[model samples]
Target: MARDRRPPGRRGLPGLGKLFDMVDFMYLSGWQKFFERRLQRYGSTVFTTPLFTKTVVATDHKAISALFDTIPFIQDYGFGSAVPPKPLVGDVAPSVFETGVLHDNPKAFYFSLLRHRATSLPAVFEEVLREYEVRWASRGRFAWRDEIETFTMDFVLRWILELKFDTAKVRLIYNNIFTNHLWRVARFFPWTRYSRSLRYYGEFVRAIEEASSFEAIMEIARTFGISDRAYVAKQIAFLTGMNSYLGLQNLFKSIVGELSSRADIRSDLDLQLRDAAPGALFSPRVRAVDEFVMEVLRQHPPVFFIFGRAIEDVVLESASGSFDIAKGERLMGVIPFAHDDPEAFPDPASFQPERFQDDEARAKLIWPRGIQERPADTADRTCPGKDVALLLAHAFCTALVTRYQWTVVKPITWDKHRYSLNVAAPMGELEVAGFTIRDERAGRPV
Candidate 1:
């Protein structure tokens, strides 16, 4: 097929409208309507101005999938620091990009490590129980949002770091990295939280500097062909700073929001989990928990769209038509759009875990890089922690409902007509506020 030789016309408004769209996008609110309106007016695939730049946004799954799978796209970090500064006190070796040939590629390293660790989820469930036991015992009243955030950080640290260092300090450093740092310079300010984070950051690096302290993780790294102790230490620090803490925290909160509104689904989930044995909760054969998790994810995928820059000239074909994509153009695979496509998802607005019971239906869902069923190891861009994140959510949910009873202090109402910017769910409601829990065993109602 011949390419569309003509230059594409402008999409939506010019000048300030592009800046406005960028602001709405950054806030994760108000931008969906803007995107939807443009897609309706133009086509499934159109070049729209976002962030003061012309970006091709594809709503059709075929176009998005091709953008992800067949066409090559380079990661664009935008203006933010590529990564929060590597521990300032380390050996100061250049990153893999500078080192050129990496024996143990970091991407492959994490993929292999997560895959191997996923097998031990049963033990991870026990850890979840212990963490909750500590929280439930001393608490009289607590905010659901705050508790979930704390729990998420604690869980991720223990699971990934194995608690070899001070958990509190590490959490602080990571929090500062995300919230306080600008151009990665906050560490230089005295008396501020960011400077304090810098101090702990060095201590945290020194602790993991040996790398051999983590025997199991080191073994996997070795198998992947990386044996440098300092290199492993640097990777550990990078992993620690990751904001998966924010991702899982938001995810669980959304789950609670859904549970608050739907008494029927919540009741069923509670009943299924309450009677199941500890081992049963981690069983691959268990469908109830899996179904619930899948549905929530399908409804509220954490990533709205996978963004990348095209590396070559390409033609993207969708239900609407084939469109020419020039080399060096920025492309966004709109995950929410694909998830909501009516042709693929009948009654796409409704929350129904039953849809995922069919393998075919499950295959249609996309989170970031690819469909849920594909192995993360197979793709360079696939989230290595996808399986682990899901497993952690499952274990935590199991612990949350079975061990205690909770009340939604504020009634939850769903607006079926609206949509979420963070989550693609139709309700447009993603917050979990005013929820409280009580210890059922002690007969205490707080």
Candidate 2:
């Protein structure tokens, strides 16, 4: 492949180029909409742009998998060079995908660690969720999105770091840290809340030290050679932020807000839950909840796009042909478009949970990124928590679908517009008017 032979992409003003997105396209539709429209016109699997940096966006699965398969990925997801690679990421284990400290075989190290922990996740998650319900059980209605966000922060902090802070305090701190997104806060100095994010993270570390003998990062430190406890904690905390505002909340809103709106779908969910063993509400035998979670991930995954840069020169192939992306050029996977592609999904944007029931459709749907049999290498930039994420989603929705009747007070859109850039919260504050808890023991709606 020759250099500069790339797929067609939208052109923007010279020097400025698609950087105009911050000002021009933001108000018109959204960041995701701009790419969706362009991909529709271009009809290419991969394309290059001058957005933020020289960007090549791909919507094809093979192209995305090829990008992750390449080793030593440096410029990934966030803007490289413009922002610090990591600030205050202290001493500890490196991430499997984006290495905190690069190594030749860190991928296997993380894969082993993550895989080992998967089994215990089910029991651990159920305990944390029970705590969540006990803490925030209320009458009348409340914004389920905000409630879930608070619950998620607590769940992650307690389960992973064993950092037990007041849930209200955690929400207050996290909200302010991302109050203005990174661009507004991180770019400016004294005005920046970036340091505050670090401070709160450090607080979690302190709390963990005070709270217990077991720290999640300590597992990595003891396993790996690094004694940099602070760094390992920071890295784990950062990645788990996927649940903080990005992955989990987006999923909750889509299911409770959108999917539940269809009376038939809600009935199916109730029937399936009723048939399951009451003792194990979301056991593997209760497969509808599993299918429902997969559909939610397929439609409104936490990330709208996946970004990475070439460590060195690399070739990316598509059904049409092959193109070479030079070292340092950025690449993005436009997940939303690919998830909703009409040909790929029979009724693409229709919120059909039944589509996921077929293994063939599930195989083609690429939003969850990579969670098939071959196993995830730390080298893979795919979401490290993919399996646990699915499990947690199932557990959460099982609780809600089985025990409560939720109604969406306000309409929600899958196009993520509300949360700060750090989070890919797919919907805004989902005002759920009536969330009445019903007795599941009776096997009938209250």
Candidate 3:
């Protein structure tokens, strides 16, 4: 008698039960090796596992794009809700997730926020960068992750929520939640000890609700006949959730690590800074902070993978062959693969700022795609705070590179182990040391 092969989409493997148990136990303990090995073997194809739940993984670009392009067939699965992690700093209340939008139309208010522009984006960039410079000037050898998180939180709050809070308070909030790995773990399992933190979050939200300014803002909206308090609140919550809940720390780590690795890149960046008018380092123009920031994004993309679940069956044409995707099958848009595609980008691995220097390259670069007609965030539900994330990242990177001359204390290595569900980060301390580059002509560090 021959051994039986498990049917597709079924649970449990005959002899691999212990292997499955080990995977569950070490779920958070470095799955990059496994993922990479699987991808190499499968060659950008979809693979399913027989486990407690049916999980599908895709590693191809064309298939991923086809999946994302057909929005109605593929939808954003609210993994955040299933995990129920504690809110990021300044997320005073349960987000739209608690209020029922998590399932209904998780992508609705998020996309709307991306569409609204109160002022010219350049002006907004200027204002935000100026704010970052003020914060960066006061820091001395601080943890890059801590400082960046606080700055990003404030930037998102001020711009999206139209609210203000003390910088120290912002840092305190983020530090308390982010560093508590135990709490983060509790978020994954509802019955865990740290689950009660949700009540505190609720309390915090109620307090914010009582603020006079919040009431006044609501009144202003009503006077304009906006009349939809729930909508406004949801939008605000979405912004809050985006900044606090997403891959912020990982981004800070990647940027600092990458900048520290190449001295030549740093030198060029310093020269760019010195050439700019005093206090004009954060400007949004061709010679301004935005250009340098774009380079950083190209080098170390924050979110490495974008994924969606098919709502209905769809067929995707690829170089290999056409693959039929069933409804609810998870598809991954391999961002790094697209970013490193040589056909799209010549010498993709080499960090060439000049790659984006030409109009042709800029048109082809995926980093700032969907900006003019359909913004990147609008196209998918995966990155809810895409615009805000880019804006904050640009501002933070500009301030660090321009105001402070930093060198990598240790050579920054992009360890594959740190690649989580989204962007990558250092598995351990990614340290850098910097001397201020005050005067480039003098060739002396300040």
lDDT per prediction? 0.62, 0.60, 0.50
Give the lDDT of residue 311 in candidate 1: 79
lDDT of 1 by residue, 102-196 (tens): 41276677777666656555675477656665665566555666566566666665566555466567667664453453525654677767777
Top of the candidates by TM-score: 2
Q: What are the TM-scores, per candidate, against the unseen true structure? A: 0.79, 0.81, 0.69
Candidate 2: tens digits of C-alpha lDDT, residues 1-446: 36647678755677678557644445565666666676677777677667665678777666765544566335344323333324433333335334444532343444555665656666667787776665444645566677777777767665555566766644544455323346345645744556555556567656655556345546655666645656555555544453344566566666666455667876787777777765364476467777777777776666556667777777777643687877777777776667766656777768777887788777765545553323444545555566666667777777777776667766655554432443344356676665556788775445
Q: Could you arrange the candidates by lDDT from highest to lowest?
A: 1, 2, 3
Worst 10 residues of 1 by lDDT: 95-104
Instruction: Give candidate 2's error at residue 334 in angstroms.
Output: 0.6
Q: Which stretches of candidate 1 lie over 4 Å from their true place?
A: 4-20, 27-29, 40-45, 50-53, 71-104, 115-120, 164-188, 210-212, 273-279, 411-446
RMSD, one per candidate, in order? 5.0, 4.1, 6.5
Q: Which number leads on lDDT?
A: 1
Q: Which pairs clash (backbone N, Cα, C closer than 3 Å) in model 2?
A: 90-231, 91-228, 91-231, 92-232
Name model 2 segments beyond 4 Å from true: 2-5, 10-15, 40-45, 68-120, 134-137, 172-198, 215-220, 242-245, 308-315, 319-328, 367-374, 416-426, 444-446
